[model samples]
Target chain A: MTAALAARDLVVGYRRGRRARTVVLDGVSLTLAPGQFACLIGPNGSGKSTLLRTCSGLQPPLHGELLLAGKDLRRLTRLDVARRVAAVLTDRHDTGRLTGRDLVGLGRYPYTGWFGRLEGDDDRVVAGALEAVAATHLAHRVVAELSDGERQRVMIARALAQQPSLLILDEPAAFLDVTARVELVALLRELTREHGLAVVLATHDLELALRSADTVWVLDAEHRLATGLPEDIAAGGALGRAFPTGSWAFDPVEWRFVFCGTVRGVATVAGDSLHATLARRILEREGFVVNPPDVGPGVQLAIEVLEPPHAAPTVIARHAGGVETHRALQPLADLARRVAADARPGETPR
Target chain B: MLTEERVAAHPEPAPRASVDGQAPARGRAALVFPLLGLLLVVVFVLGIAVGSVPIPVVDVVKVLTGHEPHGVYHAIVFDIRLPRSITGVLVGAALGVAGLQLQTLFRNPLADPFVLGVSAGASLGVALVVLAGASSEATFLAGLGGLGDVGIAGAGTLGAAAVMVAVLFAARRVRSTITILVVGLMVSYLVASLVTVLIASADGPRIQQFLAWEAGSFRAITWSQLHVLVPVLLVGLLAAAAGVKQLNALLLGERYAATMGVDVRRTRFVTIGTAALLAGVATAFCGPIGFLGIAIPHLARAALGSSDHRLLVPASMLLGGTVALAADIIAQLPGADFVLPLNAVTALLGAPIVIWVVLSSRNAGTLGA
Candidate 1:
């Protein structure tokens, strides 16, 4: 089958006049096969929304060809695109007295004739959409009264009711808590597989996207769009370039960003995972970089501990001047703070 | 984290729509239309029978059925009461629909033709011809006194159209409808000042004529005038009907509606145009009736408990007509010789309902802070 969505050298941005356009992303080409879940990542003001809007036909691209299910997007009317591509936008709305079922029913508008009365089949489609999102229990609830996660599900159901081949969402998980975001991404992924749809979502949940999305779309600091496997994109340092920061470091192995504090000392931690992790966190927070325990034992501060994940065991800190034992990481961190203030890392305390 | 599990088939769609609950709300909402329609008829009959002259209900029915009624009953029913009652239904239905559209279009509970300056625009049009027509005009234009009711109404429409154009222009340039609301208020103030200037320049005797119209009444509609009035009202209602789908989509706001294939600008244009037609034409004929336009839609929603425009359009029409008819009866005060101003009577009937809606629905999403 043809690619579910393809953009050829697409340039997206705002039009200042007839001849001048402020392009945000230029010469970008990307494709997603059916049943692929792609995440679009970029910094704020990086034109992710503009690009999504352009791809979904809500806005005209500054230049380029966008194809939806092998048809040129520019040639299709809104109704045609709406039939093929449904989007969940970021606009907050007050849906007064509209039940979840009723809100989902609105998704059938592209098929509903002028009067817009939902027929038997349309009703079934609405019901199916709600089921797909696992929101059947919420179907009778007033959409306005639902919690954030529930309402976002209903909004996604509204889009699904259109029965589009490709789904585009702009920040669908914006207000959701961590668990809700995970559940929502999983649901979208399942829908893509079960229904054979191509899904593109723009989100700020970087770890979740990297872990779950089959394809990754990254807009680098230069605003150039790159598409690759999530692993490839993460390993290639594109994520780092896109999300430039002063002190936070992306730990590729653990698949998370760890805050690296200013280093005033060098330290080594030798312990089980539980003690070592906490001990290292304390050292890092106290402006010391924690290295492995292999550096010559007496050369710098070194900590050794033995503790279960839950049990509190004593940690011994040894230095050139003296050795101190602490019951917990907090006091140890305080001591390290004082030691660093007294003398720099790799130097004996004055 | 994304994980691959053994493939399973899709969950089965629900066998039927959720029906165990919501039946009561649905049933009640379904019953409201016919009940309001029945109320409309009762009040229409009351509006006719309980005017300055207390023609008995029997004679009111007899005259309506084309039977000969005794002792000036026929003239009262045909020449005065019937026209007034018809005007009530048309004007009420028009204002109600227009108000519903305005509120939904701007997403403001307080938005109405009167609040948005459309009525003031129409009033300014009438004021120009009635108060200042003779003072300045090409002899190509005759005196205001000679510009029949139709000409005054035409003037009213021109004013409403002008203000509507400005409001639409602002809707395009301004992101927030609340800003448009404030601009509308200022525009009304400007129109009020102009009306004051016209009143200041007008001769003393003509002030009574102007005030009578300004006070608003259904009594001035003539049989010949209904020929002009009915068609215009019908056109307005039809425009509103054509826009029901777009308005429903708009309840989700413009961006979602656009993604759903709605032409947001065109929808806005049609909606504002419909509001202008109904409010302008009604104001042209009825002279700036207030409260009914704004209050009736909220009442419709409360009664039906749904914001779907399909239901709201008709519900507001019936409820508006009924309330306007009832208000007219109260204004006449039955046997009393002194008649209250129709605008005041409507305000008295409408203001509390509006206040209650705004207050009660403060957190109900419709009027959330």
Candidate 2:
């Protein structure tokens, strides 16, 4: 099967005035096959949007050949490209009085002749696109009234209404909540499998994008794009270089970046029991660098989880200032919070 | 009802509607057109009947039908009221379509033909003839005949077309719609200041004539002007009607419109040209008619409860024509000797609606503020 979209050493950028060209990305080559979900990840100003725009025919490539469905990109008219590729931009526009159905109906522009009158077939295609995106119920709701998640679903349905072989989106879930983000990614994954669509989405949601993507294209800070399977890319640790460690570190085992808070101070948890283990976990989570019991009371903040005769775990924090008592380990997590806030240096614990 | 299990991929083998199957009369758009058409006729006739002399509706109809020959009523209906009232309809409809196109093209709801400085450009064109040419030497104003209806109207068109070309050039260089709007407004201000300077150059009688023209009136339009007005306005309206697809895609903004195969640049050029032609021609005859171009599209959107241009374009035309005639009657202040300025009536009636739009926005986000 032919690749849905292929770019050979393409250069993407904008032309200033008569001669100056502002190059955003250069020497980029990639091929995306039908039925594959590819996510392009890069930091801001890394040229992800430019690449997506060039691929979807929204912008002319500065150099090199681009082929969409085996046709030279330059050879195709806007309508011809519309018939093959659909794009959803991140820009939020005023929908005003348009119903969800009205918005989705606009997607049939390439096929709808003059006047853009929706025929019966066009209506059904609209309904089917809505159904596929699970937005059938929102068909009559005015787009202005939709929540971000719901509006996004409607927008995706609009693109699907185009019935394109390839779909490109720039930050489609930029404004969605976590649940909505998951649902959107799941929907895109299903679309690739169910419709054989070559889908490419550029996004900041790294974990969500990587979770279900069949292919990953990682662009580093310097505009070097590397493409591979999600597992291979994660294991090879190219993501580390692309998005260098800052306040967060990437966990190789979990294949996701884990956010680390500022360590307030060292805390020694004195117990080998399950309760002690739970206490240590909470301390580390609250930005406490935990020390082993062998490091002893010199650590300044020492927490002991004594096995209680009662059901709850008895916890005690002996600091340089004083000793504090807690009936349970759960609330003991708040001790880290209070100390992190007011206990700068060897201050008294409240 | 074929599922993926039954027919392979869901996108394949869609249940295509047969040729006989067609779109249902969508609820609002269906009712809006004919109802607005009826209202248009009613207001237009009321316009003829409600003027100072108050020819009874029966006589107005009789004169319209040519049942009465060579009477005062005949002269009034055929020569005066008919031209004025029809000019009301023409000016209103032209501004309505032009205004609707501007609002969509800018994505700014407040945008109107005036914002483009088309009217100011026409004012400059008119001032060049009326002010500088009104002197005893006065050769340019009477290049055809003493700044008569045709000469002024022709100058207005020339001026507006010049601004239209300027705006189109500015649009090509500017990428954002917001920037284009600013460019158009600045150009408008620049042209308007030029017109003011010209006003200072003229003497008394010429200044009075220029002031009367600036006041904006439909009554000055004669049947002779209609011959020029109708065809020019028709081309603009036709251009608007043909741009339904382009306008609809444009609602999402230029980038999305481009990806969907709309020639975004061409759409911008055509939209600006059509808008300029409509407002330019109408202003040529009517002399700076205001509010209708901005207000009428909002009225149509409210009436139809839709932003779809097919519905908006026609609804605005009809509603605009009806409202213009109504405003004309009010400006005449039926049964009174003194007439009010058309601009006063249009602004008095339409400004509130714009205020309502501003207050009703849930936040500035919806207005692109």
Candidate 3:
């Protein structure tokens, strides 16, 4: 089957003058298949939006060919391109007096005749698109009256109404709250799976992207594009380098980037599952270097997570002086801080 | 959230029974257009009947239906009132639709035909002809009978088109609608100063002619002039109607409109061109009539409660006609022999509505939504 969208050695950039071109991202070759949800993650100005615009045919690629549904993007008519690839941008419009359903009905432009009368089937398609986004209740509400999340869903529904095989969005979660962000990504994922859509969204919400996206497209600081499954990308370490920070590291096991501060001291964390993960997170956040489970030797301080049957999870810290047990992480953290402050240099107590 | 779960369970056909509730609002909105149409008819009749001569509605009807009302009633009803009322309807519709297009194109509530300097450009065109044409050689140039009227109309269209092109060019560079509005104001100021200069240098009778034209009136459009004005207005209105799809797409910003397969640049050009034609032709026949161009679109939107151009365009036309005829009726000062300036009547009726729309939209946060 033909890929929904493919780019070959695509170099995206802006032309400043007749002979001057500033390249943003180069040598980007990627394919998104139907029923796949991909996310583009990068730091600010890492060319995520430039890449999206190039792929959506809003701007021409500086070099290389972009294909939509196995046909050259340059060869497709504007209407044909619109029919194949629909994009939802982040522009806040003051659509005076337009209802949500009316906004979504605009997506029928590519199919409707010159007068843009919504035929019976067009109305059905618009309703289905609204339904797909779970925004049926908002259809009658004025677009300006809707909250940011509701408006975003209506925009996505507008794109969906195009009945395009490929959908692109720029920063779909930029203004949404945590729950709305999660719901939006979840809705996109559902649409991709149910409708065989190739969905590509550029988002700064790394956790949402890592958890929900089927394929991750990581654009690193050096302008390199890496594409793979979320797990594969996390394991391959490109996710870390994409958002390069000395304080944060990609935790492949958790499939999220966690703040791994400088090595304050090596402390062994002992336990399993959720408790162990929570304890490690607290320790790491407090500037303690956590030792792996199997590597037990040469660790002066140790902490264990204990889940009692009828109480809150407990944390037990074993140090050179003695062992301290606490029901909460804050007190345990305080204990670790005191130990780090007390232990003298070159004093290895076993 | 429950909707999400239900949608996930049955993705094929999510029930849309909730959409049925909007049917009543839609039905109510559907009634607005026809009501506006009826309002236009009533106002048009009022414009014809309530003139300087107190012709009763019965006599006005008789004269309109070709029954000869003996004496000056025939001349007043057919020659003067009929053409003037029709001109009011056409001019009002043209300015109203033009204002709607300008407002949507700039995405600014403050945008209108006069606000954008198109009317000022038209005024400048007429000023140049009326003021500078006082020279003997220029008088020979203006002595070409009907060609002189065409010349003024052509010059007015060219001037409006010129300002429209400049504004469109500036709009390409500026993203903020407020900045574009300021640019339009500056253009209007510059044109006003130029008209002032022309008035200062011209002779006494010429200055009087220019001043009377500047005051604006619907009385000057003879049947011969209406021949030119009506067809131009119709063509401009037709162009605007055909562009309903593009205008609707533009409710979302330019980028989304482009993604929806609307050629943004072409749509911008055509829309401004049509708006210019409408405002210019109206300014050519009547003077630079104000208020209707800026206020009618808002009235249409408020009445219909939708920005759907399919409804708003026609609604604006009918409402614009009604408002214009009503203003013309007041300008005639029906009970007395004195006349009022048409521009004064329009501003008196329109400025309050403009202020209300601005304050309400600002309070609703719909200005930046």
Candidate 4:
């Protein structure tokens, strides 16, 4: 399938003064495959929103060519773009006491003639769009009375009513609560799969993007564009470099970063199947670590509570001196608590 | 948020369009109503029959048909009432069309000939001539007297045109609606101050004459006056009719109209120019007849159940004529020997409708969703 939107060496910015300018995107080129759910991630002022606006034709790029399907974006008339690329911006308009349905009907303007006539097919498209966003029931309510999430959904419904081939949403989940955020991500995924729409969304929630999006478009701090599968990008440490330098690290074990070096000597835990093999390896590496359970008294492992296969196990160590003889536990929570206790004075790990 | 979503789901179809979203059909249907033609017929007949010396309708018809009746009815029907009533019809239609165009152009319902300062400008022109006792025919030439003895009508036209020019210039520079309205009001005050200075300096006779004109009587209109007004009024009406399509497209706001390939700036200039001509000329001859222009368009929109100018433009013209003619009849109340000022009768009908519209829709900011 042809790329729905392609940018070639795009540079986007605005002039600050006669001689000064701030560049949002510098020589960035990328193509979005048809029907793919692409998520763009970047820190503040990293040009994510600017790139989206340039692609949607709302803003002009300072340098570069953008093509929608096979046609160059600059050559296509605004009306032509309206029919091809539908956009849902973050700006909420108070369109003077209009109803949800009234706002959606405005989406039909591109399809209508000079007198703004709407035919049967136009009405159907409007209805179908509302239905797709599952906001059919809210159609009768006034826009001013809706909650934030409801308003966002209505905005999406309005964009859908445009019936464009490509959908561009900027910060779709910005105002949504945590649960709504998750649901919105899932809904976007389902919509892309069902309609085969080339979806380009800008979001700050990296976890949700990693879980839901097929491809990730990273706008690094250096004003460069990078694209790859989410897994490959995460594994290649692209996210680590792209994000601003901070007191955080990519926790390889957890598959996402956490604020490391903030806590002191944090205890790590493993699942039942991985624990025994890990323990054996640790023993070979450090010779004094292995003390078989119920053995004689220099340092004894008195309790080796082993549950059935697939069940969790726990280990406790007893020492004559003030030392933790490597207290091993099957559950990570218990290990964390014991390690936290060991960090206190009087008890030290050998 | 869900409310907006819900509201967005059922976007209000632009007013007057059918389910298919086609241009309103009522406009085409309204053309056959022939209301103006009918009103002309009634007012002409009534003008002769209902005067101080009552001529029978049959006698009036006979005199108009040139049967050469011996009685005073012949002189009254053919020479006096016919011209006055025809003048009223044209002037009324002109002001109505102008008011509708101004309101639509500004997207302001309260917009009217006088409020936008066009009428004030026209009055200022007339005041300068009449108050100064200047018989400059070029400045105030369209009247019953020969070109040398210019009357209030001619001066009024020049003043209105002057105001139109000023307001149009201001409108071109400013995009904000409230600022434009404020500018129009300030211009009105400037013109009013000039009129005041002229009135203060005039002798008692000139001042009395100016006061009479300010009272806004239609009794001064004559056959000679009709010659100057009929053609101008007709041109103004035709210009407004041609503007309906563009006006309807403008209902979507300027940016949206531009995207739809409308040259918004050009359309605005044309519509405002035509509106200025209509108001200027009407105020020149008939003396700032109030209320009909502003009230009639809203009444037409409400009656037609649509804002599509195809129906609204003509509907407003007829309605304006009807109201103006009706006001003229009330001005000539049988019991009162002296006729009331035309504005008195118009305000009676116009004010109530405006108040009711405001009351019915608590928020005039948006049509009831």
Please compute DockQ, using alpha carbons, for every candidate against the native two-chain complex. Answer: 0.39, 0.38, 0.34, 0.09
The residue-by-residue lDDT of candidate 2 on B1-369, one tens digit each, is: 112232233443233431111232256567767888999888888899877788888888777878888777888888889988888887899899888899889887788888888888888888887777755554765573274878888888888889988888887877776787888899888988888888888788878887778889998777888887878887778888999889988888888888889988888888888898888878877899888988888888778677788788888889889999999889987346789988899999999988877777665234421
Q: Chain A structural similarity (TM-score) per candidate?
A: 0.92, 0.82, 0.89, 0.76
Q: Regarding TM-score, does 3 or 4 come out ahead?
A: 3
Model 1, span B233-315: residue lDDT tens:
99989889878888888888878998999987777767777787788889988899989988998888878878788888988
Error of 2 at B84 (Å): 2.0
* lDDT tens readout by residue for model 4, A85-172: 7777666433433456655666666677654555666666666676777776666566656877887777777777666667888897
lDDT of 1 by residue, A1-350 (tens): 78979999988988876887898889979998889999999899878988899888988888889999899988898898988889997787889888888889888888898878888667667777877788989988888899999999999999988888889999988788989989999999998887788899999889988998999999876887778998898788888888888767777777787756455777888865777788887776666767834554433578988675566788888976699887777778777778778755443221
Q: Candidates 2 and 3: which is better by DockQ?
A: 2
Candidate 1 CAPRI grade: acceptable
Cα lDDT, all candidates: 0.82, 0.82, 0.81, 0.67
Model 2 pairs in collision: none
Lowest summed lDDT over 10 consecutive residues: which window, candidate 2 chain A?
A341-350
After best superposition, candidate 2 residue A197: deviation in angstroms? Answer: 2.0
Off by over 4 Å in 2: A258-350, B1-25, B69-72, B136-138, B142-145, B334-336, B363-369
lDDT value, residue B112 of candidate 2: 88
CAPRI-style docking class of model 2 based on DockQ: acceptable
Q: What is the lDDT of candidate 1?
A: 0.82
